[model samples]
Target chain A: MTEIDWKLSQDIQLLRLVTVGSVDDGKSTLIGRLLVDTKGAFEDQLLSVRRKRGPAKESEIDLAMLTDGLAAEREQGITIDVAYRYFATPKRKFIMADCPGHEQYTRNMVTGASTANAAIILVDARNGVMPQTKRHSHILSLLQIPHLIVAINKMDLVDYSEEVFKGIRDELGAFCAKQGVHDLITIPISALKGDMVTVRGDNMNWYDGPTLLEVLESLEVTDHIDEKPFRFPVQLVNRPQTPDLPDYRGYMGQIVSGTIRPGEEVIALPSMQRSTVREIVTYDGNLEEAFAPQSITLTLNDEIDISRGDMIVKPDQMPKKEREFSANVCWIGDEPLSVRKKYWIKQTSNLGKVMVSGIEFKTDIHTLDRVSTSELAMNEIGRVSFKLQKPMFFDSYAENRATGSFILIDTFSYNTVGAGMIV
Target chain B: MSKRKLTQLQALEAESIHIIREVVGTFRNPVMLYSIGKDSSVMLHLARKAFYPAPLPFPLLHVDTGYKFPEMYEFRDWFAKEIGAELIVHRNEKAIAQGMNPQEYGVARCCGALKTQALLDALEEGGYDAAFGGARRDEERSRAKERVFSIRDEFGQWDPKNQRPELWNIYNGQIHEGESVRVFPLSNWTEMDIWLYIRQENIPIVPLYYAKERWVIERGSMLIPFYEGMEDQLREGEKPTKVMCRFRTLGCIPCTGAVRSSATTLDEIVAEAAAARRSERETRLIDHGSNTMEDKKKEGYF
Candidate 1:
């Protein structure tokens, strides 16, 4: 066995990805194969999986048992919620969100796909492209996930024929082309037989592309987060007033987009107060600069009355501050979303009462067609207009995910009933 | 690597700090459930950093089962004093008065009456709208399905089947008067991540985690550390033996089992964890049965 290079592994970047497909498309099994083949699962965990096996073929280990962690999932033989799994290779560390494939659990899929940098849409080779396949692909496109891998699983059932894989690949390619997917790749694999998933099987000697793990390892690590304009949502106001530094006040928050430097002029939205960055303070000490996603406390040169729900941004790159906007919303609550019903709209750090002004149209995920609708029910995605009681600073969801997205909470129940991405 | 770029540990820290700050910004009255374990130590550290120029905006609550390791209580007091945090210590005095013991009543009922009941009573008495816990999804099977912002009904019961969909980093801290939200900032962290973060940050933890010579008795396949009150519960001919042992998880002295190892430092602990055959929760006595954690969580077990 080769010696494990712990230092190099520690330096590798972490990738967040999600797997989505229709039920019984071998999504969980593919993840299990990856984990088991990579030795991510410990001996005791494998033993537990083996112990729980229910009289399968003597030689076959039920791979899906690895991801179906919940008791209800095991009893019903279907995944109900997103299960997060971790694994690391020599090239990169990965956090995999295994989303449920059932139609009613679209909200769960949306939840899983929200943070994912890439998505793996699995398809059974024998079944080719199903309606659920189109649905997942469309959702991935809607989420603006950077990369997509269409794995034609269960290739052994088709005798490892290249023609069968090509048929499914072409169908998906054509569909993704129309959906505006640029970074799309497809591979043939039998998740159960471990073909083209981790190790290249002998049966697929005709195929020459990289395996599933190779694709994940070599994918581009784009810094798209830092390319956008500076946007920092104030979460807290810090006042230590210590003996050494009496009267020190700073705004604490995580920079959601672009870079911020000391002495840069910024405007706090809603209040529209102007200030200059005095310092960026961290636990290690003060830094000259900060970038997207780094948590830091910013001390301004001016004593502005900025509080939470305020967005500090570069003067020239100001986001839209408005009370009315249209957005694509996914209804997550059991109750249907009615027009004019009051709900709490939480956008970034800002919270305000909002009501649905109009329901434009809902997308039929399977057919990729827009159908007019007056209301959005559970697990439905639609474009709607909202009128907020107060103005909010935001960019389009395509420009910056952190500032563009919001969730609606039921006024009375206080449950998060809907998720929206600003158009 | 770029000098400005953050390592995975640093990234995780930033995310957790953002979450802690969000909880403070969103909820009117929130509290941190500090268990004096390694996860709680990390969580407390993040909370401190989340509001660095100022002290923590909220208080820390420790639900004492009256059966925890004495070292845990000591560390809890010392850490609270060091951070200058408002620590609220509560226990189910009624259960203690009723003489409910894990040794006699079994782990499930004892935990329900002591730990779970104590937490609920404290939440109610304090009227806390949001409570932060250090639960991680990698710890147990059912926990893998838990949302970062988990909602509880008026009875403080979690309905797993009807949980609201959590998308992106936007957590829903919205709740009615009697309802509450359990916020877990460490939801995505694993055991390895916890140890790595603790080592990187130099966070203080209970000494029980490091191997030490202690009196213990072999029970079934586990080595239970001998506490002062265990004499009456010991089986016939079960004599105490001195063993070099360390606890994988800290809980009630009677329920938590120690593993035999000489991992005296965080580095050794991380190496041991990487090469270990079993998960850390395998030795936990409360999660022995199938779906036990799920059942406990539905009834308000953090």
Candidate 2:
């Protein structure tokens, strides 16, 4: 809290992770234990949790009460929405998404996993891998989460047996492998008894792997934005026209991918107008160069009629400009998504009217099988094709998440109805 | 320092700036809620940075409850003029005429009329499609699940149970007429982050946050500042005492409690907050009304 050196703190990597599992798989308990063990919970919060004891024994604390903040959630003894928790260790800072386990809240899990770099899927040792586990894993795979940790929880109930851990690990590994998830790790833990969560537990001597926290801290933090092709979706045009600098037309936006340097030639998409980067301006000062995720304004050499919803990118590495494309859609609205229905599609800074042209199939998360379907209901995932009123710049989701994803908004209600990942 | 690697504070600032720009780009008429607090100061700074070179794309709306600390009003007016931001101040004139005060009518009803109702009236009169707030997730439990772009119904009610799923950096600012979205650019920022950013950016904040010797009366566990002409509200044996104190949050003078401290600088405040054992909202009297924060948010409170 004492003002630390800002430059040195940049090395402290940030890991966005999600905790998922079936109902009562100890997901909330694990998160609570992590926070409590790390001194993330303040003294007053701990006291309040102690005061509001559910029906537990007098000496025992309900760890699940920490994440269940809503009154309705506490009354029902279940997580109803995705609750984000922040905590920091010496090695790294973490923003954890504690997602709901109910089958109906699959959309909530998708929301949490979409931004996560890794996922910790909790599996009860007694139940092994249930149908919900497979369902959650499939969604994570589709979302392209980089890493996954399968924590075989409740080892205390299973006598810390190596055989049970191996059996569950092998089964879960096979399932994940079939789904093309290669970066997977499995550990045995007892969240209730504080085993292998923060510290190395002696109860799990049979397992010689890093603890959950250690694995999370040591995982590679991928910076895909720095490596991918440059993609800048212009959000606004700043024309100050001041006496100090007349005719100043700067395009303002956050660089979604790659870097921009002075004198680099770029092309404005949808218009295909070419220009050179004249300057990179920030509130602090002008920068020599700027990279992905940095919100800066760029002064182009050309005086093209560029406005909002325009994209500036490397000419040779331009995203495909098309009017029709296939994408994997996650239906999130109360109404079903039908073919030929018009809806507004917001991709990056571009907004366009789109209609579903075809529904190829829907994936059965539990079975990992494709079923031929004509319509997608609420919380359903399907591979569909859409026809846009105007050409949109894009990339495949597997290549770049920033430019590959979009949302479908209801034309009448203006509610976000679907999330689409371009295929 | 490597230009490729941004510090955590820098990363948070970039994300917030992105959100602010998105609101300006998508919404027809957007306004920022300026409460003249540290969070709002950080938010206003980010808005300026987000649309630099050009003036701010939206006006700033401050809901004056008619009982805020005098320093807060002074800072609000001075800062708005300095930044040249179009500022709009709204108050429930009818409620004031009806003599609605927290001490007379209790905290909840007075807040409902002066704060919540005043805001609803302002939004309607301005026809603002998007209003940005500076609420953070780490401050309260219910806010931990709030989306970056939260949608409100025509009546300005927030449906916490069925909020839209916010994914990645993409925010959904789509809304129909009479319906508005409450955007929280600082949703991911914590209290520590706010102070650190304020110090790092050298942003000007109200002087009330710093410690000063002020007359206060101890009510239960709170140190309520003694205001002139409010002598009848005191208990039988209680008396006002001058103490070195500072406000953790700026609100109505009667509701916002001051913590006894001598942390006069931002660095000291950051260190004190880090070592403190209680959350900032714990001292707020408005939060004590039957889980009032969530209930008020449901009733269109910011």
Candidate 3:
């Protein structure tokens, strides 16, 4: 925020990251070390810790307490909810959302990993891989968070042996590769000892690679925005009909995908008004052009009645505008996904009256396979069909996460009951 | 302004202007909450730009706690007079007259009665359907989860976990009767962004933000100043020491402290803020307590 180009100088890259493992796997400890070393913690918070927790006993500080802030969470010594933390290196910025690993909170883990770019599955070198690890890996594959890092933590307890590290890493890597998560990075680390985290440790002579921070900083954000279809949902209508500037109505929204420029032919959705791009407008005024996720205002040559909840797109790249569609969903609420349940279906500004057409299938998290089912329960991940009252256009979730991604809103309650990636 | 396409600043300005207009069109009887803070000041300026050729459509509500800086009042009066807005000033005179100093009744309780409660009481009394606030997301962790049309219960409480899922840009302001919503047009703005926008737009704000000479006493890590009716509570080991100080964030004197600074100008303040060793919330004593705002929000304390 200090720099006008902070978003650019530290280019905004949405990285979907997941930290998965069983309890005492030192997942929280690793994240805490990253934040502290990166200078993300404030002095007051540091001061509070120094005054209360005292010095770290011949070791590094407890970084886990910084994130697990709740009294219940601290008392239980575990993370309950998916807490999102924002940090940036000179090269890129990362949005790390850590998920809870309790078996009861498996739904929370799926919720956390649904939008991730990479998966950090912590493995205790001594304990090796457990049933929960397989479940986590299965969920990661099903959700399609591309990258994977198998961090074999607590290597010190294993006498910092490379043989133990290699064995655990090899087994998990083989399992994940079989599950279609081919892109994997294996690292042996001691979260408690600050080994291969922010700083390299002396014990790991067998490893020759970047530290965890280096790997995270260097990991490509995967510029997939270029391939997704163009979708821009208008947020505001800026028509300052003052004497100084009249006849200047612009439709504003961040581009969900694809590109836009002056003179490019576009269509206003629902209304289906075909118009030429008169100009590209922004809060800063007009841009020569704009791309996906960059909020811009488009002024058309025609005076079409486009309001909020309306979308704009390329004339040819018009999404699949249909009344019914198949989707892969993660049910978040206690309320089950039943047939004929009317709720506010929010797509990219094309709000539709949605109901469960039929429960097509639900995925078994342990197998990464689909199971034919009629309904979804709390924390249940499944594939289902939805019926909307009106036709709203969108691409598949695999094709475009921006336009394809949506949440089910309970009409009266207004709770986000389920998260969906359109098929 | 002559048919010139929008710049990034102008684009942000335009989007904010549109948000202001929607608040007017969507709500029954809308009002803008004027705190005279820099954020509120920017909101007011944008409101003026939003509905130019016509005065601000909504009446500006300033829930005065009577513990404000004198300069803020002066600026408020002058601006209100110049803008010709239907300015409504509400205060809980009973609480003030009862000598319920923040020191005695606790900061949270005192703020609850004077500021938060008074504001809620005023909104209910005025029947303001929607009130525009200058809250930004980057201000605090809790604030980071805030949406544009943040719906509050009839008692003016915010439920973080229970908020409506706001997607794209459209906001849902619809609520049951007796329940009002908070409209934050500057939800994306950061502290540095506010200063930069102020510098870019040349918006006028109170002089207290800049370094200035005034009788002050230092306590804890902050410079406790000599303001009217405000008493200093120094512990045994503490002593009153004066140093050049200015406010990064401002509220009631007891809660909002002056940080030690030499940056007297806006540019200097921005630079100082960039190089500062502490978070802006560190100076805000209300946030010092782990879940102070969260608790207040839960208890109909707003």
Candidate maximizing lDDT: 2
For lDDT, candidate 1 versus 3, the one ahead is 1
Q: Write the per-residue lDDT of candidate 2 for residues A157-239, one digit (tens) a residue.
A: 99998999999999999888988887689989999988899998789777889999899888887666787899999998888
What would the per-residue lDDT of candidate 1 be over residues A1-423, giving only the tens digit for each residue? Answer: 232445223456678999998889998899889988887676657667777775555346777877787778889999888888887777777889998989888788888998998899999999988877887888788788888999999999999999999988998998888879866789899999899999898998888999999999988766667768999999888887778668899898999999999999998877888989999998778888898789999999998878998889988998998889999888888899878888998888888889899999998876667999888998788899989888878989998999999999888777788889999
B-chain TM-score for every candidate: 0.97, 0.97, 0.91
Give lDDT per model, in order.
0.86, 0.87, 0.72
Q: Candidate 2 overall Cα lDDT vs. reference?
A: 0.87
Candidate topping DockQ: 1
Residues B1-302 of candidate 1 have per-residue lDDT tens digits of 77656677778889999999898888889999999999999899998888876778899999999888999999999989998999999999989999998777888899998988889999999999999999998787678788888999989999887778888888777777799999999988878778877777788889999998889999887998997767987898898899988998898887888999898988877777766667887778888754388899999988
Question: Which of 1 and 3 is the better model by TM-score?
Answer: 1
For residue B90, give model 2's deviation from the true position in Å.
Answer: 1.1
Candidates ranked by DockQ: 1, 2, 3
lDDT of 3 at B283: 75
Judged by DockQ cut-offs, is candidate 3 incorrect, acceptable, medium or high?
Answer: incorrect
